[model samples]
Target: MPKDAMAQKRGGWIACPDCDTLHQCGPVKAPHDVKCANCGRTLFTRTENPLDRPLAFALAGLVLFIPANLYPIVTFSFHGVKTDNVLVTGVYRLAEGGFPGVGLLVLLASVLFPALYLMGMTYVLLCSRLRQYPGDFALTLRMTQGLNRWGMIDVYLLACLISFIKLGQLATVLPGPGLYCLGGVLVCTLLASLGFDPDLLWRRFGARSDKAGSWNLLKPKAS
Candidate 1:
């Protein structure tokens, strides 16, 4: 029997990440969400356009990423003295001001992990689009999973905006290109996260391979 037929016959199972309970499901169509039978937690949503949506947004986010981090987030001028701040300015300032721990948190949450997550997501999705899973694909996917929760770019962006408002009162504060770029990347990443469908990946990369079609199985059913 073909692996595809075998998969269809068994109707693959997905384990609830929250409760370790298993649920059997078939090839569900888009515009529907699969919820865990035990925990009622949403396992994943079937997007109308699966890899394409995340791929496009992740690419857009990547395009803006360099400028977002490299350029000045904002500029402040007081009495003919002007200074420009980039995304990492807060981290540096915090460390210099006796808040090393806070600075590290800012670095990890707002900058490092988020950048890695976006890059990994883009690469993983791109590989999926090309139907070529590299040796590091699984590793990259796992990295994205751990890094997703730490992306606090929006929080840091909000902080920058507040600083802009307050510094405007004290001096001439101007929004910089980096600020706009950061905002764009944030929106793109948010949309990418929303549209990402992990099940597609499971089907392509996690299933047992043969001459037959694929199975979208993330975890094996309990014995």
Candidate 2:
């Protein structure tokens, strides 16, 4: 018969932060706070809540993503000549304005990155919920981390706001509702990514699947 998968063990001896004493803890089956057995120092406790929190955020992101992609992210008026551009449209405008390089950069930063981040996050959340053990959990974790860096929708929004503020009289600029919705989605996705604990995936699935450990082992140990 195949060996039993390594499930997360709940009860264990945790090192006391204050006294350096090892304290026996009961099963941490839920999110709560516990005290060290010897020093009574408070310690964080968490259960296998799965990916419910992240899933909720991902769903919210999906909802907001519609507007972010559908409506204009920025609107500009120069001498009463109004022009509105969404994320992709901005890239096209930049290219047409003889800034092909900048257009490519913006396309990668604002369009591709945000979409990839959302899709990756959604995949991870759904997979975790289904209890489907990914062959490379570490790869998924790294993808999520990469997504965090690439999600620049919020930054783009800020840039638009700053530009609008500075060009108030010369050329009026206004943000569209899509911009606000995209901003919301960006924030929610970030929060969801941060709150997601990759360790939880290993716990629910199995240890052999944790590639993070391999990565950790490759790193030089601290003195």
Candidate 3:
């Protein structure tokens, strides 16, 4: 069954990040540099190694992710009333306050997606470092892409800052360890992305199927 799925997998075909132009780049060499024919945008460059800087940042992010979730984001002291808000508590309170949809979005954007992205990157990079192809490479790529897109820790941070500012008028809102840890995670995630190239996965995946090229993945797949 895996073989059959692998057989159907096609190779090549990349998109320009700038102008959305599609290019069919057959087989690229190491230091895989390719420019989009339409927009002159560099699509894929540098065949990344898992043991490089990207891996380091990703590992660091994973380490910080734990405390970011466990620790309190902020401590609110209002007229001798002390309330410490952890990340999960914030989500729970939001749901309990009749904003379940927003709470769910917050949970996914702030907590679940960020952790999944870090884990996914670590897994894929480690597997590549060991010269192992994932069971379903395309699915893994899609998952990571979705996770990356949804991981909105920055948004959460913004909301926290706004809350701090607004609440500070009437109460003392002290920044907690979780806030600092989350900042570290966000920085690490950005750094990891700067060095890691998902396109490198295509180079390895192309080995299995070379008869045709990948179609327009920008379009959503049919259910």
Residues 7-92 of candidate 3 have per-residue lDDT tens digits of: 22344455677898866666444456678888777786654442477788999999999999899999999899999987889789
| Model 2: lDDT of residue 95 | 96
Preferred candidate (lDDT higher): 2 or 3: 3
**TM-score of each candidate structure, all chains considered together:** 0.81, 0.68, 0.77
Q: Number of clashing residue pairs in every model?
A: 0, 0, 0
Query: Quick one: best lDDT, which candidate?
Result: 1
Arrange candidates, best TM-score first: 1, 3, 2
What's the lDDT for candidate 2?
0.69
Q: Which has the higher lDDT value, candidate number 1 or candidate number 2?
A: 1
**Candidate 1 Cα outliers beyond 4 Å, as residue runs:** 1-11, 207-223
Show where candidate 2 strays beyond 4 Å. Answer: 1-50, 134-138, 208-223
* Global lDDT scores for all candidate models: 0.81, 0.69, 0.76
lDDT of 3 at 7: 26
Top candidate, metric TM-score = 1
For candidate 3, which ten residues in a row score worst on lDDT? 1-10
What lDDT is obtained when candidate 3 is compared to the true structure? Answer: 0.76
